[model samples]
Target: MRGHDRFNTSLPDDLIIEIFRRLDSKSKRDACSLVCHRWLRLHRLTRSSLKIGASGSPDRFLQILSTRFPNVTDIYVDERFAISPPPCIQGRKRSRDNSKVSSEESCGSVGNVDSPYLSDAGLAVIGNGFPKLEKLNLIWCSNVTSDGLASLARKCTYLKSLDLQGCYVRDQGLAAVGQCCKQLEDLNLRFCEGLTDTGLIELAVGVGKSLKSLGVAACAKITDSSMEAVGSHCGSLENLSLDSEFIHNQGILAVAGGCPHLKVIKLQCINVNDDALKAVGANCLSLMSLALYGFQRFTDKGFFAIGKGSKNLKNLTLSDCYFLSDKGLEAIATGCKELTHLEINGCHNIGTPGLQSVGKSCRHLTELALLYCQRIGDPGLLQIGQGCKYLRTLHLVDCSSIGDEGMCGIASGCKNLKKLHIRRCYEIGNKGIIAVGKHCKLLTDLNIRYCDRVGDEALIAIAEGCSLHYLNVSGCHQIGDAGVIAIARGCPQLCYLDVSVLQNLGDMVMTELAEHCPLLKEIVLSHCRQITDVGLTHLVKSCTMLESCHMVYCSGITSAGVATMVSSCPNIKKVLIEKWKVSQRTKRRAGSVISYFCVEL
Candidate 1:
């Protein structure tokens, strides 16, 4: 007893609390709390954030949570809370009928008034419990209405950021928020269908001076009136995202002329012509990031204005802008010489000349993505590869014109590349892949999905040089045991691998994986009919750290093999296989240990 007491030196309370605060994992903190009563009290005092799921009784749970972690300033309510209604409201009938409830009162009439799932009463409990709450995220809480939001706003007066995505809150809630939360800076109301111009105007008038970031994407009822209100009131707004078909050039012009200090703007499916874009370029000189999607009306004139004016632009994304051609891209590339990231999707009119201009001008470019740009061919890619030597990530999807020459150029030039993804670029084959494997020594992630021309030669080269952590050659029918065996032998740190639909892969590859890749966690062998029970057993017995294993449609695996894997692999959590291969006994026993998914016959 004396020896044990001598070793038990008491640590200072402040030092113990600091140690608890440094722990990153919740489970680790919980374990530390179990050591003694003093440690548990210190852990609770240090914790400031709590994420609650929708499984327990809200009243009782919130009571206990407030008692234990009284200092928590942030709370995130899971989406599952809306899917599964609270148990207290399961059998109770709503006080108001749906037919009698008007559109304005729908939020308050969702369920029983006493129930916490849909009523303002539930929010009152949270507001009363956590008065110091600064950030609250209630994403997908569709049943909560304006009354609940008003109650929460009145109590949590210090709130700075509020995310109510997919909620049923309308104008009344915004009015309450503006009246109560004076320091609010960040607000997201994306997918809030009930919000209209009236509510937004109220919110803007109240909190416009303090607001920095505002997102009202997909609010169909809002029109030019709301944008005008925001521009007139919200002078300090910097980041804005607006998605509405009703908004046109007049609204965009107001925002551009009013918000001169804006840094980021994202517009989706808005009916704006070159005039609006020109206004943005001329007025918002501080803009650094811009994303435009499905704007068919914009032409080269708008892009030219942006390029000529917003010279400090660093990131730009253009998607489905069919009318914008090579001239527009060239203008942007020449003007925005400091661009670091560029993404072009479904812009078929922009071809080799535009890309060549980008390659020549944007030497600081680090990331580039070109998707469904059929007109962009090998010459364009070659120019990019030759110029953009500092590029780290490159993604080419459905760019059928890209061939071996373009890929080889990229491989040789972008020696610092870390991630490369090529999907459905059928023109690229073994030669291009071999060049990548030979030159890209720092490459950690490589995905060549559905590129049938890529085979063992490419994989063998990668295994020999690149220390890849993730490799996915799924749908590459030419890949076999020789390439995979080489990977197993060389890339010992490989964590994720997918060889689905590779018919030539057999037990030899599994044997090699078992012998070499002990850290392997997740593997997908779907549709590989050649893999047998022996190979499955060998993999599970050695790779004890495997958490997820998928072998769907593998006819050679039987119930015995499935049972062996479920019993032997201690860390296995998810196993996906054919329904017919699992026996009733195995299913019953595995139910407690792992989640098993069956592919229906």
Candidate 2:
């Protein structure tokens, strides 16, 4: 030990720092901190990012964080810090009724020492502490008002990205951001209800030139005027996500006309129609990704315009656009030949014609999602399978019309398919899945939840042909021990597995897993009543690398089995079981090794 210490001491500080810089894992760095005071100090100095959650003493926590990671450029404070009040303020009486308190008073009361949550006082500490902070994510910090934001903006002048999602930042906060934080580029003000057109205009006028990405969701008061101001000012904006009730064509038109370099746009609006989309297609020639949700008024004409203009569009998502039929989708497919990803959900009118158009025109398409598009059947999938041979991912949910034929087509055509998720598609059966098992040699992730027709035959086929990393056949009642055993024997690289609600699964399956699966990290055996303590012990003893074990409602499992699992698996982080199954002794044992031992009621 002395010789080793002497040898380590001979290594220069710069070499040690370089070694620490190479460590990408937080756990490895934490272990280094325990080596000695010198190592701890070096680790702290090298740390450049910090994420903090609820602490008993927030002031002390902030002090330690600032002292340890003085060079941290990014800080993320989770919602727990805002929701969980410190003990000192928990028992204090409110000066006024909670409901009657003004937003400003509730959030910006810096003088109020009794503030339960992290108020402006906490923000002041942050502003003064981290001088190098370039990114700050105060997500869902509702108690943080305009005053806190102003303070942060003034102090963190080099801040490039700010996420004030669910904060009480009003016009004052926007004004401060505009006046200060000249280097700010990315801003997310989602769910900031206090923001109006006035505040948005001010922000656009101030930081529009440098801002690259902006998200303003659920800001009800923002209208066309604010968007017009943004369009006129924010010429450099590349990504924009807007979800507002009052925004219409005029606002969109202004944005399209101004931000010529815009690459991505996500809009969820009630008033936006074909005209706005036409304007976007015509003006934003650089657009690569577009997502429209719940836009009831958009029709084929708008899609035609988009296809005609935005030839470079690679990704498109249309959700709940009930008015858009096969014609609109066909138009898009014909124009956007470079599209790599397309997702259509709740567009009931879209059927085989639209999908066929996509398969024929968008040969480069790699990912496709059809959710609740009941009109689409095997013909549509067959078309896709025949045309889009490079397709890698396919998601089908509640597409009742799609059956074995479609699945077979997909399996045969997309030989390179890596991920396939099918849920509530009862029509698909063993024939379809077996084909996938045989054809998709590179299949890594498979989820067929609630696909009742899938049985042991499908699993056996998959186990024989494919080396899957993730497999979730939960609620597939037809799958039994044979299927699981085959999987355990075949998939040596399997990291995640969920066989929840399989009544037939028993100790035999566990025995197979123990002998075959050494890389299994997470397994969900929820409601598998036949799983007993004997099998679980064997499994836990063998699968030492298991990180998460969920055995909710496994009636055959007892305290002794739980104790063995918690004690044996040093890397185990989470365990889920029934409330009654966790004895006092087991709880104590689990409390040390497990980070989250949830007791399901």
Candidate 3:
């Protein structure tokens, strides 16, 4: 028997189906399907999920999906309006086209009508097709109105998770979901401005016992009363997110008093003070993750109360909490020993002393983010590195005072670091990056954006030592073609690279990247003036797997260069080549036409 035949015979059909079911990534499953016909059939039969509505025509996608995967249980229809209609829409007219055209004209004559590609009729078709769908995501489906949502909700009664983010969902649509999807456990209504207290009350009463997670961020109309309804009815609620200027202490107290099982809460730009946080600390006994943002009225007193109450807290994010000082951080450090993930942003008053307290107290801290915290310097990082020896991820964006000494200190202690971002820390030079590259062997993602002093020495060191999958050296003018070549040669697994604004880099870097980094999926070369048609053509031809190429303000590139790249990589979605003012059209052939892509002047 041949190798394929032997392999197929080795594993039984049941075993093959079980093995294929365990594979998570779509790409991996696809590769496995290509092994043989038996595996292909098994893969298709076992697959139960599909995501469309981004590129292909929604109508055609629905027909194909219904025919191919009749047993699909989950569908995510994200019909983005950023680009024009896809290739499947052209030269194909629906039987109802004449009626749609006439109705559109009438609507246009009267007023504005946001006639989205995926209309109410399309949603009805989907509802009829996927009756067994348990999860449905209709994010950014702007044209989908209350009628369409109601139609979908009425049909998909088995839906446990429903995401209508950025949709035109209002009281009526929410009411429909509440009435139909009684088994719904997760609901996200982010950016649904048309929703209000009436809708919330209706939803709370309908899905009160089953609802576990709720997201209402950016829904400006939702008020304190709305939250009160949620707290009163959603007794089983475990996760809640609220944002905007309305939610206050009353709402916080209501939610806390009602939902004792709440484990996660994210409050952003709300008018809640120390009283609200204190309530959460006292009542939310199971709270483990808490995120606070734009709490101008909150002070150290609130954090102190929170720390004392929620001793089991594992994740905390504080952003724009300007009033919080060292005392608050000290309180938290002293109280919450279980804290493993912490992110502090725009807290100007927090310095090395506060960080030291956290480092010393929360020894298990594995993830930390300190953005725009200017008071932190070398000593602070040293303290953190020494105390949090198990640290795995660190992000220090625009912490201008940190230099080589701080980076070296971090490198010595955080040996297990996997991701490090030091954006706009201009004081640090090649030495700091070199230290990290040498010590942090597990680093897969590194961003040194706007660190102009970084040169080939640091890049070469990282390339030699680490196998990074994502690297962004944007605005590091000191790096050139030689540095990129070293990176391509050493780190052959690079998937995303952003070397924008490197004036010295030419097509040579592209050639090297194309030849070595076969896994490169996205490349950003904005303002790379030296890169020309010669280099770009080689890149497109060699790196056929590339999905997106951004080359803004590259004066050397021309219309011909873009044409060559697109013609070769026809599946490429985003090819942003602005500032060069290049636009070219290829002659259309039978049964095929060039897809409309984004091209701005």
Candidate 4:
């Protein structure tokens, strides 16, 4: 059907690259690289980022990376595990073994192994190799120390963003980074217990003037001293996230008062009161986003102060703030008219008036999430639907008082709504979900997990109305083949379906779903005992693109059925089965037969 000139040799270099770019998976890309020399070269050159995992020898991998992909700018080194010893230790194994411990003894050492994958030696190689590196994320690289970081900074002077979350980098490492990496703009040091105020102060003094974003979350030792240094030097800082108990009101005030151009701030589990809020409001008038969590000290007074002072505020999130009431919410509604996204979780004090005020005032609000707010009933949702007509994403979780009335209001008003998640709302039934489907035809993602009252009527409505790609109706015992048949007929483009724990689902629904939903990739049938081998055979034969099938506690599925499924769908990667169903040898064979098979039983 084709000639030699119409092949790869005739295609232009740019066209080859454009075609290669469209390949979806890594296997396809790797296969394309094997075609010719030009393709391999183009593939190598087009790549810009690299991720090195803690699997094989890091030294050898680094050597390969340096040789094959030399122009990589972004590198993410995940050192979450320990494999064999580093090349330095391996080379001198015999000599080291005579005086020091053996491999078994080394592996048995207490706590986490330092430099399990890439150690100081590996860092030296990296520093020498990637000269043009800009962004380096060594997240959970617990072994990297001061020497390695200093070497990286000295060699890679172009580095701008560095994340060392969960690393053991201490004050010395901070000092090294501060002294060498002066141009660094974004730095995250979350959960690094080795860091103290002295280290933080040195870092602030070194790059504070140039730094734009800084995250020092879970660094409990950091105090007002470090905050003072950051406030004084980091005047250009626009975003800061601090989750520390040691840094009290003094630290908050210092940072707020000093960073005049500050726009975004997130504080968690801190004992900050109205004084800190007032300082933030007064100084950071340009602030647009603020998030506070787990504090009762800053009540209505603090919120009112923020509302009155920071009139340009747009995004606000409050969680577990028991002290906040309708008064505080009203204050926010009156002041922050430019608000677009609002999320309130675990704050039960606010009533219907609070949501109504927010909905009426923040007319441009597009995203809203109200979770674990028992006081918010149908009245609150109705008000939100009536006022915030442009709302696109809505999440109402554990709001037991909300029922069909709230759903009707949202369906009637918010025509542009796309993503809706209502979980554990016992009051909501088929009426609410059906109303949602009847009104919101543009819906793509819908999650009604643990809403036992929703059944065939709701699914039928959803199938007819929305072109849903992801649908989750887990724990709805009333759902049966009729509802699933409706889904198969309506949502032909469905890719992900979760019908777990439904008692009435049988092989008929599975057969129809497999035959109709050609795009179906993942399906969860856990606890659905009615599904047998007939369903599995039909699913494997029809859904050729299926990747993962979770059938935990599915007693009807035996070893023969699983074997048949593997034979039918060679592309099926993950087949999760309950532990006690098959033998150990069978489990091992299943894994060998399929790419990814889990037998936890």
* Candidates' C-alpha lDDT: 0.85, 0.86, 0.83, 0.82
lDDT of 1 by residue, 197-262 (tens): 998889888888888888877888988998999899889989989887888998899889888889
Task: Supply candidate 1's per-residue lDDT for 438.
Answer: 94
Residue 324 of candidate 1: its Cα lDDT?
93
- Report the lDDT tens digits of candidate 3 across residue range 1-601: 3445666768789898888888888888889999888888778777788776545345444654565566688888787643343333323343454434333322222112223345666677678777888998887877678888889899989989988888887799889989999999999989888899898889899999999999987888888998899989999999998887888788889999999999999998558898988898888888999998888888999888888999989999999999999999999999998899999999988888999898889999999999999998888888888889899999989998889988888888899999998789899899988998899899899988999889999999889888999999999999998888999999989989999989999888989998999888888988999999899988888787887788778888877877776778756767775533445353231113233334544
Q: Give candidate 3's error at residue 201 in angstroms.
A: 1.6
Q: Lowest-scoring 10 consecutive residues by lDDT in candidate 4?
A: 106-115
- CA lDDT for candidate 2: 0.86
Tens-digit lDDT string for candidate 4 (1-601) = 5545666657788888788778887779889898778789878765678887785456545655666677788988877744443444344333344654344243232222333466766677678878888898887876678778888888888888989898887898788788888888999989998899999899899998789998987887888899999999999999999887887888888899889999999988457788898898888899899998887787898888888888888899999989899999999988888888899999989878899898789888899999999998898888888988889999989998889999899988898899998899989999988988999988999889999898999999999899999989899878888988999989989999999998888999888988789899888988999899888888888888888888878878776777767667757777777545555555666664333335545
Q: What local lDDT score does residue 186 receive in model 1, on the 0 to 100 scale?
A: 91
Task: Return the lDDT, model 1, position 21.
Answer: 82
Residue-pair clashes per candidate, as listed?
0, 0, 0, 3
Report the C-alpha displacement of residue 111, candidate 3, in angstroms.
20
State candidate 4's TM-score: 0.89
- Count of backbone collisions within predicted model 2: 0
Q: What is candidate 3's local distance difference test score?
A: 0.83
User: CA lDDT of 369 in candidate 2?
Assistant: 97
